[model samples]
Target chain A: MSRSTPLRGVHESLGATLTDFAGWQMPLRYGSESAEHNAVRTAAGLFDLSHMGEIFVVGAQAGEALDRALVGHLSVLAPGRARYTMIVNETGGILDDLIVYRLDEDQYMVVANASNYALVARELADRVRGYDARVTDRSDEYALVAVQGPRSAEILTALTDADLDDLKYYAIVPGVVAGTPALIARTGYTGEDGFELFVLNEHAVPLWNALAEAGKDAGLVPAGLSARDTLRLEAGMPLYGNELSAAITPFDAGLGRVVRFDKPGDFVGKAALERAAENGTRRRLVGLVARGRRVPRHGYPVTREGAVVGEVTSGAPSQSLGRPIAMAYVDEGALEKGSLAVDIRGSQEPVDVVDLPFYRRSK
Target chain B: MSTIPDDLSYTKEHEWVAGIEDGLTVTVGITAYAAEQLGDVVYVEVHSEVGSTVAAGDAVGEVESTKSVSDIFAPVGGEVVEINSAVVDNPSLVNSDPYGEGWLFRVRVEEEPEDLLSAAEYTALTSGES
Candidate 1:
């Protein structure tokens, strides 16, 4: 049986379609996923991200431990700030993309994808063995709720007195929302201004209800995993299983910037990553805009003149572009030289190569 | 619960057939239950040409939604008389009014369908599955 989140009852009350995702029974959508997607772009959308894992690494050398365990230089990150990083194996293949938050001088929170968090926790525990820090999997004790979109700050302002204006992007602050303590972070996967609130499991329902009531006039709707997927795809975010995997390195995914070669330490994947950086990858990740209505799905072959050249990683019908969009890893040379098409169920559908992120919010 | 019209017949694949007793032609479309499961229809295609013969269990077309896609099967063996162009242009019709404006195609009856369920049977099937 799939595990249920703390707000499963609330989701059922709202008539959501529950689907098993990453071993958790989560809401896929409340009503129309398109409406939820639009709500996030225009107004605000609430999300129950409790399925995400939160592993705490706390000690005198927490930052140093993370620096050796992951790709980013976490030792230099200031308190109350988060950085996108990845953990890789000895072969330099990405294990999982993570958000590491420096909560204090000797404490850090590594937020990982639901599917790979268990393995990530084990890896961190083993990787930090020599360091003074200790790893604790606090995923079950926390519930993460996110309010995302243009009016996210406004919705949050009604509940908390924290300086939403002063909170920079990728910053987190401790504050009380709806009489419950929460760690409010200005971070989100959707390409919109948003805040993710981390609270105790007991405080989830009330916090969600308070935000819903306060943001009712601001057109805040509860979004689900379906809308979240499309939102992140439009924002050009890479999912764990689709874009990042143990078989693919960060360099192959065109996300080599996350790998910190300058950091002075023997990280797990340091030698292999340096070699990968020196010898560039054969296939590069690119955005594909479908010329036809058929959506290029995961595992679909990206072909050049009937010859298989690459494979699609993630795809969906883009609401913002009014057409279907996909991300695929194709040969870098074929990208510049020849026409490409996605073999969608035996029929070749033409596609145009575009930059990452099918949609971006105006600043 | 999704609305299942008592006048129409349903297939186990979640398709509804209309005018089965009219003796000439019947309209076919996916049930509302199927549409709700699909969650936002994006693209729809009818593969059975207007003048082509199709077997009862043969796949005729497909409906693509935001989350997934499902094949639209022929409920009964017949000749494809016409396809709904409106649904082809705007696939959202499948979710908005699945039984009415979202009718997929019309078929000239070639035989009496042996496998079909009444409205009550379909409701029971969906309820048990859910």
Candidate 2:
């Protein structure tokens, strides 16, 4: 049996289509997924992200332990700030892409993907051994709700007095939302200005209702995993399983910047990452905009002149771009030499090589 | 619940058949339940073009949605008499009006269809699914 989030009943009441995602029964969409996708692009949308894992590391050596275990240099991250990072295996293959939030001087919260969080927690516990720190998986204790889009601030301002104006991007603040204590973070994967509220599991339904009520007039709709996937694809964000995998390195995915080789002391995969940085990658991630309406989906062969070069990682019909978009790892130098196409089933649908982030929010 | 028109006959593949008993030509479209399952339809391609012959259970066309793709099979052996170009241009009509504007094609029948389900039977089939 698949596990359900705290807001599963609420989603059922709203008539959401539920699907099993990463062993969790999550909302696929409330209604027309295109409507939900448009709502997030034009106005706002609320998301139930309780299935995401939250692992806490606390003690005097919390930052030090994280710096040794992960790719990013976490010791230098300021309090109440978050950084997008990743965890890699001994050979530099990405285990999971993570968001590390330095909640306080000696406390940090690591947010991981649902499918890989258990392994990530176990890895963290093992990596932090012999240090003055302890890793605890608190995923079951929390419920995450995100309000994302242009009018997210307007909807959140009415519910909380927590200076939304001062909450810069990638920053977190301790505040009360709808009379419940929560941690508010100004971060999102939708390429929109939004806040992620982390609260106890018991408060999930009430918080969802409160956000829905506050956002009713502001055109906030309940979005689900379908809309979320398209939105993040348009934003050019790499999903863990689809883009970054156990076989794909950060450098191969064009995310070599997340690897901090200059940090003090030896970290996991440091030597392998250094060699990868020096040798460069054979296949590089790039964006593809379909010239035709046929969607280039995951695992589809990306070809040049009928020769298979790489495969699509993530793809969807982008509401913001008004066409189908995809991210694929194509062999280097083949893109500049000739035109490329994605073999959708059997037909070679033409596509244009575009830059990452097919859509960017207007600031 | 998705609407299952009482007058139309349904295939186990989630397609509805109209005018199977009236004339040589019959209309075919995916059911609303199938459309809902596919999410927003982005592209529709009918492989069996007009004036083409097809056998029963032959894959005639395919519908591409945001998340999935499904094949549109021929309910009965027939000649493709007409294709819905409007749905080909604006595929969202498949989700908005699966029975009316989203009708995929009209096929002139060559043989009697076999094992097609009544509306009640289709409803029962879908009831077990959902």
In order, the first chain's TM-score in every candidate is 0.99, 0.99
lDDT of 2 by residue, A195-221 (tens): 999999999989999999999999999
Every model's TM-score:
0.99, 0.99
lDDT of 1 by residue, B68-124 (tens): 878889999999999999999999999999999999999999978998999999999
Q: Which TM-score does chain B of candidate 2 obtain?
A: 0.98
CA shift at A306, candidate 2, in angstroms?
1.2
Counted clashes in each candidate structure: 0, 0
- Chain B alone, candidate 1, TM-score of 0.98
Candidate 1 stretches with Cα past 4 Å from truth are: none
Per-residue lDDT of A246 in model 2: 88
* Per-model DockQ against the true two-chain complex: 0.89, 0.89
Cα RMSD to native, each candidate?
Answer: 0.8, 0.8
* Docking outcome class, model 2: high
Report the Cα lDDT for candidate 1: 0.95
